[model samples]
Target: MKQVKIAGQVVPAIGIGTWHMGDRPAQRETEIAAIQAGISAGARVIDTAEMYGSGRAETLVGAALQPFSRQQLFLISKVLPENASRQRMEASLDASLQRLQTDYLDLYLYHWRGDVPLAETVAELQRLQTTGKIRAWGVSNFDVADLRELWQLPGGDQAAANEDLYHLGSRGLDYAVLPWQAEHDLPLIAYSPIAQGDAWGQQLTTNDTVKQIALTHQATVYQVLLAWVIRQPQVLAIPQTSSVAHMEQNLAAGDLILSPKELAALDQQYPRPTHKERLDII
Candidate 1:
């Protein structure tokens, strides 16, 4: 697996996203096995949130991680927008930590901008970092303007990454958001890098160029799509799966380096943005 430098830490280029993991009791065992498969395949980063199944995903992660050394994983969890206030954020982190069965998180994030001020949130995150509660902190669904505004805050530069919707069809971030993060050496963590598993049904998978690349590499269209997202050095993609087979496919995709010709063909099929557009979020 490939690794990237983000927030002064080296981590896997692709992580596991546990969006709907612990919601169903019957599927719990399968989901846990899938995560364990990802870890066994060299995926060190695991992203979850308090909002995900209302912390049920965190609980699943805690149980799945029991077999591995806590120090070897980079655990990330996000606080909901309603809990952005200092006191509420603290409580949320504490609750997440308890559910995750960990002493500290590798990275904690604000789910999205809310009524709470960025400065206040950043201040609280810094305090948590200072107290060894979290290694680093970041924001999600922030646009270029939001990033600019955050940069002007008292301790906003401490933000480690900005996670948003990024896939073959959703390239709005390339216009400005991605460039901004790259300039600051901030990692652009892409959630739903495969478009919530809809990429296979979308035109991206059916395009002739995509088919050609898949054929040339002896890979599935979904794997090609996943590869395209993590092709860049500044980007890290988290694609969720409930099956160990898909987990293995995703990890393999991280290593499929696309050629310039293949990349150009895909670019022609899905052109990059020439002007700024509103960043897309799930």
Candidate 2:
């Protein structure tokens, strides 16, 4: 499997994302099974957040991951912007830990910027590190300018990763964010990596180039998309799914590499941004 070094640990480039999961009691078993299937398929990173399902997702993850050794998995959760303050951060983290049924998180992130000063959040995250509740902390929905601002803070240079919306159709990060992260050796944890490009109103799934590339690799179009997302170094794709078969297929994409020719073709279909484009979000 292809691997990306994240927060000083090498993990599979493809991970399981738990967003909008654990919302329906009817689908609980299926969701747990899908996540377990990904783990059994060699996925080591499991991304969740306190905001997801208002903690239902983390609760589901806690149950799904009960059978696995904690050391074998790199678990990531996030604090809501309102809870990112020094006063409320640790308490929120504790609640997340309780939901996750774990004592510590591999990575905890500031879900987004809020009224709290960035320094307060960063300082609290650093303090949490000393408390052993979180190994490292990062940010989400952060653009290049936000990242640059973060890097200038006292403890900001220690950020382990950044989670953002990235997919074949959304290439805004390609112009600046990717380059900045690559230069700083900070890994990007991409969310919604296989949204089929429909979010941007593009029918990327039916694109001729995408179709032919999927055919060439004997993979699903979504799999081809996942492969393309993690084709670069220090990049990880966390694509959420509630089907065991789809989870397995997504994990398998870690090993699917597009050739230079194939990549050029995809580029022709969805060209990289020439200048800064609007940062796409879900």
Candidate 3:
């Protein structure tokens, strides 16, 4: 239950991701249990998006969070790129709020860059903040250049965070995007920290390096991967889980500290960025 203060709000270092939460009817009960268990275990941040399961994820989150105190939870949701225009963004926000059964979101993000003008979208997001529909706002899947352009706008200074695919294998953001956000004091929400269960195929969890580290700590390969992502103070890793057991394991990873040598070993396996590279998105 480690906490990180980002964009003037305090949140858990490891949040619960609801990417494919409500997609399958058979898994609904387990999904709900996982979310509730995470919250009860002191995971305050929960992230979801309208595009996830076509909004069914948000609905499930709403139902699962009914008994919790809204003020204590850091709820986040994203608007699709196509719906980022001013009018559509507003409509989408309302729909998301209804589905979440909440009056305001702790953080609202633009899913990705779209055809909509950045200035207009920033203005609308600021307006939403003014009206108390959202507390803070940010972007997702934005690289350094996109972030630079975003900051050029009038209300862009209010940008809170940027989220993208960040994991042991995908370290592109370690080059420029991460440093830029750190300089601005904006947190980077790392989605797919385990590569959406592709970590096994990518050798993230099965490789000798990871295996050795896990053995040293008596931890699972998954915990080692989760630990690597959130080892930084300013980064937040949201790894989705449907089992309460896995949810507890994810929360415990917040305390899994990696030594400099172990980190170096990982770097050798998945080299950190040397020069500017396009951000990775999932």
Candidate 4:
């Protein structure tokens, strides 16, 4: 497994995302299996969010990871945009801690960007850090402008990482976010690193290059796509999987390497659309 250091802490470059595990018993069992499989495969980070099943996902993750030493895992949870106020942030973090069955999270992130003042959110996160409630703090789904605003806050320098949707099909970060993060040494936590399974069909179809490369390496299309994302400097991908077999496959992506020619060909196949176009669909 690959590792990236953020705020002086090392985290797995490939993590498990526990979003699909809702309140159902079967779903919870699958999530537990997936987490154990991922950890066995060398994943050190596990990401969950408050909006994921309205907190049920976190509870499932807590149950799954209770056997492991807390310090061995880089646990990350997010607060939704609507709960961005200082008071709400505090309450939300406490609730998430209780659900996660952990004393403190390795990282806490703002789930979205909205009307709340960035200063208030950052300040509260800083306060939590001082109290040792959260080891580090960052933002998710925030653009370059939002990051710039965050940097102006009192303790923004302590912000460890930024989470975003980054894959071969989604290159919004390439235009600005990637460069800004690189300049600031901010590690990027990539969600949908396989393009939510879209890359395996639309992006790879009729594209003989990717097919040839995958065939040459004896790897699946999903593995090829995930390898492409993890190849980027400072990128950590968290692809969700509920099945143990799929979890193993996702973890194997970290070991698959793509040739420069193959990488260039794949990049040319998926040109990113404008942010405006993306927002329209969202």
- Highest lDDT model number: 2
Taking the tens digit of each residue's C-alpha lDDT, what string does model 4 give over 1-282?
667886578776788987667668767777798899999888888999888899999989989997887888899999988788887888888899999999998899988887788888888888888999888898888778878988887888678999988877677788788888999999998887876667445665245776787789998777777888888778999999888988998888888878878887877777645453331112
TM-score, each model? 0.97, 0.98, 0.97, 0.92
Candidate 2 achieves a global lDDT of 0.94
Is candidate 2 or 4 superior in TM-score? 2
Q: Which stretches of candidate 1 lie above 4 Å from their native place? A: 199-201
Give one digit per residue, the lDDT tens place, for model 2 in 1-282: 999998778999999999989999999999999999999999999999999999999999999999999999999999999999989999999999999999999999999899999999999999999999999999999999999999999999999999998989888999999999999999999999987346667887888899999998899999999999999998999999999999999999998999999999999889998898878877
For candidate 1, lDDT tens digit of each residue in 1-282? 677877677988999999989999999999999999999999999999999999999999999999999988999999998898987988999999999999999999999998998888999999999989999999999999999999999999889999999999889988898888889888989999888766446677677888889999999887898889988887999999999999988988888989989888888988999998887877
Backbone clash numbers for all candidates listed:
0, 0, 0, 0
Candidate 4 lDDT score relative to the true structure: 0.82
Supply the TM-score for candidate 3.
Answer: 0.97
RMSD (CA, Å), candidate 3 to true, equals: 1.2
Q: How far is candidate 4 from the true structure (C-alpha RMSD, Å)?
A: 2.3
RMSD each, Å: 1.2, 0.9, 1.2, 2.3
lDDT values, one for every candidate: 0.90, 0.94, 0.90, 0.82
